[model samples]
Target chain A: MPGQRQSQPLLALRGVSKRFSAVQALVDIELEIRAGEVVALVGDNAAGKSTLVKVISGVGPPDKGVIEWQGAPVQIRRPQDARLLGIATVYQDLAMCENLDVVANLFLGREIHRFGVLDEVEMERRTRELLHTLSIRIPDVRMPLAGLSGGQRQVVAIIRSFLGSPRLLLLDEPTASLGIQQTNQLLDLIEELRDQGLGVLLISHNMSDIKAVADRVAVLRLGRNNGLFDVNTTSQEQIISSITGAADHAVAHRPHPEEVWP
Target chain B: MTNPLPTKARVAEYAGGVRRRVREGGLGPAPVLLALAVTWVVFQSLNDKFLSPRNLSVLSVDIVGTGMVAVGIVFVLLIGEIDLSVGSLAGLAGAVFAALHVNVGMTEWLAVVVAVVCGTAIGALHGFLFAKFGVPAFVVTLAGLLTWSGLMIYLLGPDSSISFSEDGLVASLTSRYYSAPGFTYGLAALCTAAYLLVSLRDRARRAGAGMPCRARSGIWVRTGLLAAVAFTTVAVLGHFEGLPLALLIFLGFIVASDLLLRRTPYGRQVLALGGGVEAARRAGVDVTRVRVSVFMIAGTLAAVGGLFVASRFTSASQVSGSGMLLINAVAAAVIGGTSLFGGRGSTWSALLGVLIIQSIASGMALLGVETAVQFMITGGVLITAVIFDSLARRTAASRVRT
Candidate 1:
C-alpha cells in the first residue's frame, strides 16, 4: 500500500545514447512519461526520432545510459524484453502482413491455440470486440490487411498492441498517411487511451497532432534532446524552432560570445 | 427507376457480385476449376478411353507420387521460398531406402523410417544454412539439387536399381488395391457423413460465437455435392479396382496437410512469415525454427513421395525421380493455386495441380502424342496458372486501393 502511494514515472530514460557505425543516431537523450499522459516526440528528418524509439522499445538497446521502469533501472536488450515490461510499439509501416486477414494479423505471433489448433473463432470474436470498443469500423474482419485502408490498418496495428494489455504504447507516425478524419479519429483514440491510464509516447512530425492530444512535447534535434515543453504553454513557433535546431543556435550565441563571431 | 421484388433484387445482386469478382480476378480457384473441366472435356472427346474407369484409376494412382512432393512444396512456397532439392532428395530417399533395406540388411520398416529421416536431416541442413547463416534459399537449394542427385547415384552403386519384395508394405502402398464394392461405397458414405457433420459443427460454433456462418441451404448444397462426387468417384473406381491404396494414401495426406495449414498455429506462422517476414519477426515468431522445420517437412514428404514412386515402379531406379519429377511437382503446386509469390495456397492445390498434370500426360499419351508436345502443354498450363496468380494479386492490391 505504501509502495502504491509512492507514485513514480511509468518510464524514464536518463542519458540514453546509441550509435550505428559512423552515425551517432541518438545522443544523451532524456525523457520521462508518466501514467495517464501522452508524450509527443517531435523531430525533423535525420533527427534520431526513430533511433530513440528503437532504443526504448528494445529493437536496439542504447549504447549507454539507463532505462527505468517504475523508477527502477531495467535492461531492455530485445523486443521481447520490452514487451514483457508492457511496452507496446506500433511502427510507422504498421508491421502487418498484407495477405493475412484482419483476425490473423491481429494475433500474429501471439495466436490463441486450443488443443494445439489455432482458435480462429475466439480470435475473431475478440477482434470484433476490440474494434467495437475502439470505435473502429472495418468493412469485414475477414478481409486481408492488404484490402484495408491506411487508417484501418493503423487502427488494427494499434489494437494488436493492446491485445497484450500493455502499460505503455509507443506509436511512430501512426497518422502519417491518414486523411484528416482518420487523423482526428486516431488522436481521439490516443486521448481515450490516455484517459484509461496508459502512458503513450507518440512520435510525429505533425505539431498540430502533438498539440491535439499530447500532454508534453519532447523535441529532438541532431540526435540530442532540445527541450521538453508543456503542450498547453509551448508555442507552435517555439516547438518548430527547437525541432529545426534554430533554438539551439540562438541559445549557443548567449552561452559563448567568441564562438558567435567565428 | 423502379424497385424490384425482394427475391429478384437479391438474385440480381448476387449475380452482379459474382460477375464483379470474376472481372476483378477474385475468382481464386474458379478459373483453375474451369480450365480443368475444359481440359477433361477436350481429352474425353479426343479419346473415349481417357475417361474409362481403368485409365482414370491408373491416372489417380500416378498422381500420388508427385502429389506428395507437391504438397510439401506448398509449405515452402507459402513462406515465399523454393526448394529446388526436393526432386533429388526424392531420388536419394528411394536409393537410401533400398540400400539400407537390401544391401545394409536393415529391417524394411526401419529402413524406410531412416531413409525419410535422412531426407529430413538433409533438408534441415539446407534450412540451417539458409536461415542461420543468411544464405539465400535459392543458392543453398540449387547446390543441394546437384549434391543430392550425386548422393543418390552413389547410394544406388553399380546395380543402378533395387526391387522391393512383392509382399512388402512399401510395394503394397502403390500396387495394392481394394476391389470390394461394399468397402469402396461404404468409405464414400463415411466421407460424406464426416463432411456434413463437420460442416454442421462449424456452423454451430460460428453461430455460438456470434460469427458469420454459411447458410443452412448453402451447407446442405455443398454436402450434397461432395456426396455426389464421392459416390461417383467410388463407383467409377469400383468398376476397375475399387480403390487404389496409393490414391487413398495421397488423399489422406492432402486432407491432413490441408488441416495443418488452415487450422493449426504452425500453418499460420508459416503464412505470416511468408506474407511479411519482418512483421512476423517483430510479432515474436521464431523465424529460424519455422524456416528449418518447413524444409524438414518438405524433405520428409519428398522422401515419402520417393517411396511412392519406387513402389509404383516396384523398384528404386537410377532415374526414378529425375527429369520431369521436380518440374512437374513444382508446376503442380503452382497450377493448383499455390502462388509462387507466397502467402496464398492450400494442400488441396497439390492434389488439383498433380491431377491436372497427370491427366494431361495420361490423355496425351493415350492419343499417341509426342513427349515433347506433352511437356509444351504442361509448360503452357503452368504459365497460365502463374498469369492467373499474378492477375489475382494485382486485382487484390488495386481493389484495396479503390
Candidate 2:
C-alpha cells in the first residue's frame, strides 16, 4: 500500500478496529495521512468515519491494531494525549464560550501568566500575532464568540487549534451548515492548512469537498474500508461505488460491508 | 540631527521632540473621587453635619459589613455568578459562633474560628452542588438564604440567646472612635504606600515579561493624586475623630477582592466560563471546578460579612439581616461597575460603589432625610448605576468587531 511515501509520512493507522457494544464501528481500517496533504475520509452516516477520527485523536480506544506516528506505534488515551502529539480537533458543534470575546476564548485554558498573575498584555499581543498569521481579518479581537457569524466562529476555531502549532488537525463537518461563501472560505482554509505542511483529516459528507482538496481519499463502508485511492487517480464514480459497497464489497477476502455490518 | 548636545540630552530629544500631551485620560480613581467631592459640596451646602468628621467616620463604619459582602460578591460576580444567601449565611455563622461559646464552653476566640470554618463548610457544600451537579447557583444560594436564616432563628431561642454589652469586644469593633489624628494620618500613609507598591511592582513585572508598561510619569501622577486624596480625607477626619477600624476592614476587603479578580488564573477561568462554559471546557479549563469554586468563595465572603454585621450590633437576631443587606451588596457591585450579565468587571468597582452608596446614606442621615425619601434616592441611584453599566457594556462591545 506504500507508494513513494513522503519524506516523513505523518500518521499511519494499521488494522485499526473499534466496536461499540455489539456493533463493529471500525474494522481493521488501514489508512495513512501524509504531511502537507489533505486526506478525505468520505462515507455516508455511520460509515465509521467519525469513529476513526475519535480513535486517531484519542477520543476512543481502538480495540485492535496500531496507530503509528512517524514509524513508532503510540496509544492516544485522551484529548490531551492527542494534543501532546500535536493533533487538534474541530468538532461539528462549536466548542467555545459564546459570551466571551475572541481574545478571551483563544486563551481560555492556556493563558499567559506572570508570577501567578494573568499576563493580559502578552496574551493580547500573541492573539494579534496569531490572527495576523492566519490572515483571518477581524476589525477587533474583543467581541464575544456569539457575536460572530457561524462561519466566522469556525474560522476562529481553526485559528485557535492551529495556534498551538499542531501537526495533525481533525476537522468534523467543517462546513456542513455553512452557506456558499462560508463553504468556499472553509475550503480555502483547508487548502491553506495543507500549504502550511499540516496533515489534515477532513471528515466531510460533501462530495465536492472530497473531490476538491483531497490529495488521497479513503472510503469506509460500514466498519470495513472499501478501498483507499489517490484522489488524483480515482474517479468520483469509483469512490461512490467503494463507499456504497460496490467495489471489493464481496470478494471473500474482501467481503461486502453488508455481510459484515448489516 | 544638528543638535550637538550631551548623549543623554540628545537621547531625550532626538526621538522625543517637543512634548505635547504628557499624559492621557482623566486617570483611574479620579472620576470616582471627583464624583465624591462634587457630592460632598452639594450635600454640605444642604446640611452642616453632612461633611462632619463624626458623620464621615460613622459612614465608614456603616460600609464594613456590606463592604466585605460586596467584596466577596465581586469574585462571584466577576465569574458571572451570585450568592443570595450571604446575609443570612453570615447570620448563621454568628449563631454558630454564639452556640460554640455559650453552650460548648469554648473561648470567644475559638468560637470565632469555628464560625469561620462553619461558614467555609457551607460554601463548600454550595460549590459541590453547583459545580458537580450543574445546579443553578441562584437556586442553590436562594435555598441557602432561606434555610440558613431559618437555622439562625432557630438557634437564637429567646431565653438561650447571648448578647454583647456596650464594652464587649465585638461591640467595640463598631463603637470605638479614634479622637487623635495619628490613626488617620497612619491610614493615609499606608494607603499611599500600598498603591505605589502594587502599581510599581505590576508595571515592572509586565515590562520584564516583554509586555506593556505604564508611563512612569503617569504612575507618579496617579499615586500623587491618591496620596493627596488620602491625606485630605484624613485631615478632614482629624477635625473630629481619627480613623475607624471598619474603614480599614472595608479597604482590606476591596484590595483582596481586586487582586483575586484582576490577577488570579482562577478569576480568568471564571470570566471565561461566564462568557462561555463550552468554550472554556474546550480550551482545557476545568470549567466545573471553577464554577463551584467561585460560588464557594462567594458563600465564604457572605459569611464573613455576616460576622461584621453581628459585631456591629453585638447580637444576632432573626430580623438582623431582614432589611436590605442582600440588595445593598448587589447594588454596590452593580453601582461600582460590575456587569450583571457577567464576563466584564472589577472588584474595585464594588468598593467604589459601596463608598458612594454609604456616602449618600450618611449624607441623608446627617440632614435627617426622610426614610421614604432615602429609599427613593437609593433606588434612583441604583437605576442610574444600571443604566451606566449597560451603556458601558454596549460601548465596550461596540469597539470589538467579532
Candidate 3:
C-alpha cells in the first residue's frame, strides 16, 4: 500500500511566513504530512507553532507561503475555504458554546433542517450514533456542554471536526486538559484516525503524547524549523534539544558541579 | 437509549430533571411567575377593583404597546446585546405614521407600512455600524436614541403632536375586540387544541427517532395548564370589553417569535452567536448577517409597538416613546428572565415581564399612588431582577468550572 501511494503529500507547507505588524510570527517554515501519518509538532513558547496551524486552518492566512494540498497549490483565505478543502481544525480553546447542548454544538453551523426548521430529532439520533461509534459515553447528549468534563468537551470538539469527514485533521493540544485515562483514550482515538488513512497534525508540549501516537516529530524553535525526526528512530532528548535549540549549546553538554563533587 | 420506560419511571425522571435544572440555576420561569402571583395578591389586597375585569382588560391593552417593544429587546438580549434606540425608534415610527396619515393625507395602512419600513431601515443601519464597522452596540444604539428622538420631534413640527381621526385602521387596533362569547371562547379553544396537537406530534416524531420523549402524562398536564390559563383570560376579558385586538396581536407576535427563536435555523444561529461570537464564527455562522437581522427585527417590532402606543391614545405626541417607555421595555425583558448577558432567554419572557410591569403600574394607579413613588418602586424591582440574574449567572459559571 505504501509503494502504491501517490507521490504527493496530503498537505505541504513550503517556505510559509507570517508577520503580525512589527512582529514576524513565522519565518520560512517548511512542513509536510502524508496520508495515514501522525505528525506531532513540538515547540517552545513563541515558536510559531500556533501561527503555523492558524495559517493552515485558514483562521489567519499566511503572509507568504505555498500550501500544496493533494499535490496542487491552493489558497485558503478564510475558514470556509479551508472547510471546503476538507481541512478541519480543533483549536486549543475548543471554540465551543458552553450554553448549548452537545447535539446543538455538534451540528451548530451545519444543522439539518426541513422546511427551514431545525430537524432536531434527526440531529440527536445521528449524534447518539456518532458518540456510540466513538465509544464516548455521556449521560445525556442533550445536556449543556458546561455540564461536561474537560475531557468530554475535548472529545466532543474532536467529534465535531469529524462531521465533515475531512482529509486532514488539525488538533491543537487535544489532551492538554485531559486526565491520565482520558489522555490515553485520546491517544487511542488519534491512532484510530491514522489507521483510517487520515493525515493528522498533532500539536502538543507533552513528549509522552508525541511518542505514543506520532510517527514523526517536527520541532520548531524561534519561528524556524530546527529538526524533524522519525519517532521510532529518535530519542525524546533529541526532540527536546531540537525544540529548545540547545543541541549545540555548551550548557546542554556541561556536567553538573554536584555530580563532580559526589 | 430508545427503549421506552415505564410511566412511573418516566414521571420520576421528569421530576428529577426539573429539580436538577432549578438547582443548577436554570430557574426557567418560576421566580417571575411567583413575583407575578405576589404582585397580584398584594395589589388585590390594597384595592377591591385591582383585579376587576374592566381593569384587567385595560391592563391588557396597556401592555401591548411596551410589550411589543420588549419582545424585540428579548431578541437583542438573547445575543447578549442591547438596543437602546428601540424606545426612540418607537416614537419616530408613530410620528412618521401620524404625519403621513393626518398631514400628508396618505392611506392609514400605507402610512403604517412606511413607518415600519423606516424602523427596519434604521435598525439595519445600527446593525451595519455595529457588525461591519465594529462599533459597540451600546454606543451605536445610544446615538440612535438621540438621533431618532430628534428626528421624531422634528417630524412632529411646531405643534409637537398629531391626532389622526378615530375609526381609521390604526385607531381601531386598540378599540376593536371579539366581544361575542362564542368568538372569544372559540379562539381560546383553538389555541389550546393547536398547542396540544403540536406537542403530541413532536413527541411522536421524537419517539419514532428513538430519542427521549416527554412522558404522555406530562404532556396532558402541560396542555391542561395552558387550557386553564387560556379559558380564564378570555372569560375575564368577556366580562369587560371582551378580548382586545391589541392583546391578540401581542400574543400572536410572542408565539411566533418564540417559534422563530427556538425552532428555526436562523434563530439557532442568533442563539449560537449570543453564546460565543468566536465559536459561532468558527462554526461557519454568518455573524454579521445574524446580528444585523436581529437589530432589524428589534427596529421593526419597536415601530409596531409605537403604533400600538399611538393607537391607545389615538394620537402621536412627543411623549409617545419617551420617559419610562424605554426603561420599561428593557426592564420587562430582563425581568421576564431573559439574561442581559444573552444566549439564555426566550421570547415569552417579554409577555410575562410586560404583564408584571403593567400589573404593578395598573395596581398603583388604582390605589392612586404617586408617580414618583411608582418610579422608585419600579426602579427597585428592576434592580432586584438584575441581582437575581447576576447571581444565577455566577452560579452557572461556578457549576461549569466544577
Query: Model 1: per-residue lDDT, tens digit, A110-173?
Result: 7899999888878887887888777777766777777777777877887888898899999999
TM-score of only chain B in every candidate structure = 0.93, 0.85, 0.97
Q: Please give the lDDT score at residue A152 for candidate 3.
A: 82
Model 2 misplacement above 4 A? A1-37, A41-82, A91-94, A97-104, A121-156, A172-198, A203-213, A218-229, A236-262, B1-42, B159-161, B165-169, B175-187, B190-194, B197-216, B387-402
Q: What share of the reference contacts survives in each candidate?
A: 0.65, 0.45, 0.56
What residue pairs are clashing in model 3? none
For all candidates in order, the CA lDDT equals 0.85, 0.74, 0.88
Position A151, candidate 3: lDDT: 77
lDDT of 3 by residue, B254-284 (tens): 9999999989889999999878999998888
Docking class of 1: acceptable
Candidate 3 Cα deviation (angstroms), residue A13: 1.8
TM-score of 1: 0.93
Supply candidate 1's per-residue lDDT for A235: 93
Candidate 2 overall lDDT versus native: 0.74
Q: Can you give the DockQ of every candidate in the order shown? A: 0.44, 0.27, 0.54
